[model samples]
Target: MTTTATAAPGAHLPEHLDFLWRSPEPEKAYDVVIVGGGGHGLATAHYLARNHGITNVAVLEKGWLAGGNMARNTTLIRSNYLWDESAGIYEHALKLWEGLEEDLGYPILFSQRGVLNLAHTEQDVRDSVRRVEANKLNGIDAEWLGPDEVAKVCPIVNVSSDIRYPVQGATYQPRAGIAKHDYVAWGFARRADEAGIDLIQHCEVTGFHVGGRDGDSVTTVRTTRGDIACGTLALCAAGHSSTLLDQLGIAAPLQSHPLQALVSELLEPVHPTIVMSNAVHVYVSQAHKGELVMGAGVDSYVGYGQRGAFHVIERQMAAAVELFPVFARAHLLRSWAGVVDVTPDASPIVGRTPYDNVFLNCGWGTGGFKATPGLGWAFADTVAHGRPHPLIAPFGLDRFVTGALVDEHGAAAVAH
Candidate 1:
């Protein structure tokens, strides 16, 4: 049976009471309205209040909090990119990950176990060398390790020449690792709520009410529950970014695709660090509970369905066994997929749209999870000051026409 209770306004609930017990109903107007409640959106709201004192905010989610891509990734973190633009933003996120737990006052289980991107062929070696050099130039910590060094770092990897894709060498980032994905979302959500930011779930945005000169401003948002007037509207929707933008008669350069990941039954710890192989199309790291968290490339076609084909899973399993032959006997626990928004250049878009008051932070492709804190920090700065932050200005939508894309396809395509 459903139970209801009432308390005096502004009264704090007991510690044992659920956080949802005191959640306020959505207000009719807000200074800022965030259209998605994933990690990025929640983080944006938190920073908006914590950094800028913009507490009159609303975060609208179509489903339960953190139920989207925030909960559906393999949880790998890294900042070793080839370009300066990509390196700067992602490296910013890596730094934030260092102090995030203390900042949020929540346990996120961020482990700096290191990440190894294995190279197999001659081209892979060349790419690794170039990327490590560029990363160093951008003040990112990166190193190219030979096969012998790779084996020392990760003792179980099959560096033998007999494998389908031999591990010729690898690029290692000692700071790159994995964190608890769900905890990341919940931590931000809890902190945002504590700062009086409304987190409205099960509220789907139906259309946008655009007004002002040439309809360049979004005055209100029409959602399933009701209309909400807002001074500024920020779109942080991941795969559904294009759908929501289309309601405003704006088109985003994004395509939605399914990215698959799986976990194996719990076992004793054997994998010491995160391992990824682009040639074999697989990447893996052992979870805190000893489950082997694994993933590969995205599906070839566009899909809104949160599932991939069996053949894709089959190929990923083949690749996993090819790299770590000891994983051949591990039983599968669960497998699932999340819809990711892809762009032509394989980088994120995080700036103002053509609209005067509407901003977008989509096109993260398959790498959005690692970029959550950085995206939120820059996006909140953009929405607060009506200008893109210097760190993310290079990712503006104007780049598509100006032909100044910060293409990171070589690093972002696989093993995000």
Candidate 2:
């Protein structure tokens, strides 16, 4: 249960209880209403109220704060996609991360150890070189590193110089790194709550009370218990976006898929820089506490299900053990899975939907967690002005309608 401390009227300004311990009464209609109390939703609300003049806002979360994929991500931060638009925008996210702690006045524990994407075959090498050139041309710091260099960064990798699937090289982005996940969410939440945004937890959206036949407006959102009147709605529901949109007759071009991540027992910090390989279909990194965090491909099919067959985990372990001999002896500690909503082009679909006031911020594939802050900023701009930000123009939902997809599927496999 969520605990609440009573405050004098107008003490916790926006909607009284800061984080809204109870839905309380709708009190008054808000300027903006955000769905899914995850990081993106919370950060957008924070930016909207603090950065813009839109203070009257209500954030509706189906469950507790940031308990969805925002909490389940592997925490690998990077902007080294194969395309410039993808890299440039995500790089902007990297810059934002550099100042997150100060902006939130909270320690985020960001680590800039860099990311190492490995190439195991000739094709892998070609793709790696092509990507490195693409990234460098885009002003992102990316370079090709051979096996000898890969050893310098990831010495623990059990790679043979001349063996089959030999490590041809790697793409290193010194600008990419990892940050504390929950801290990001909490940092955004604390600031938004302090700034007078109503954060409603456990307020599942039962349906929508949309106005205007064009579906370009929202009158109010019917909740499990109450109806919230708001000028606009932003959906940051991720894996649940399509389902939520379906409730309002808005068809989202996204489908949900399950992705699993596992962590090993605490060991001496054996892994340093993040390591990813498409050939192996595995990627891993070690946390400050020494737990080895790892992930593989997502389930092929679509479902809200978070559980997958044990064989998927088994497949991932084989590759991990082969790459790093040390992992062969480490005891497995825990494994968990999350559902992800993917768009056709493997990029996030940001900005306006058919519904005038309802905006979408989903489809990061495996890269949403770290993109939270920047997405928050851009998304808030769109909602406040009812216009798309130039930086995120390529990812508009209408891109699909116009055949202007910026496909980054090749680099996105290990992107986040």
Instruction: Give the TM-score of each candidate.
Output: 0.94, 0.92
lDDT of each: 0.86, 0.80
The sequence of per-residue lDDT tens digits that candidate 1 reaches over residues 1-416 is 10011112333323553553235678999999999888899999989998899999999887767677888899999988888888888999999999999999988999999999888899899889888998899988999999999999999999898877788899999999999998898789888888889988767888878799787799999987799999999998888888887787777688888899999999999999999988888999999999999998789998777776889989989999889889999998989888889988899889988888898999998789898898888889999999999999999988989999987775532528
Looking at model 2, the pairs that clash are: 216-356
Could you tell me how far off, in angstroms, the CA of residue 249 lies in candidate 2 after the best superposition? 1.5
Total colliding residue pairs, candidate 2: 1
Model 1 misplaced regions, further than 4 Å: 1-17, 20-22, 410-415
After superposition, which runs of candidate 2 have C-alpha atoms over 4 Å from their true positions? 1-28, 162-164, 213-215, 410-414
| Error at 318, model 1, angstroms | 0.3
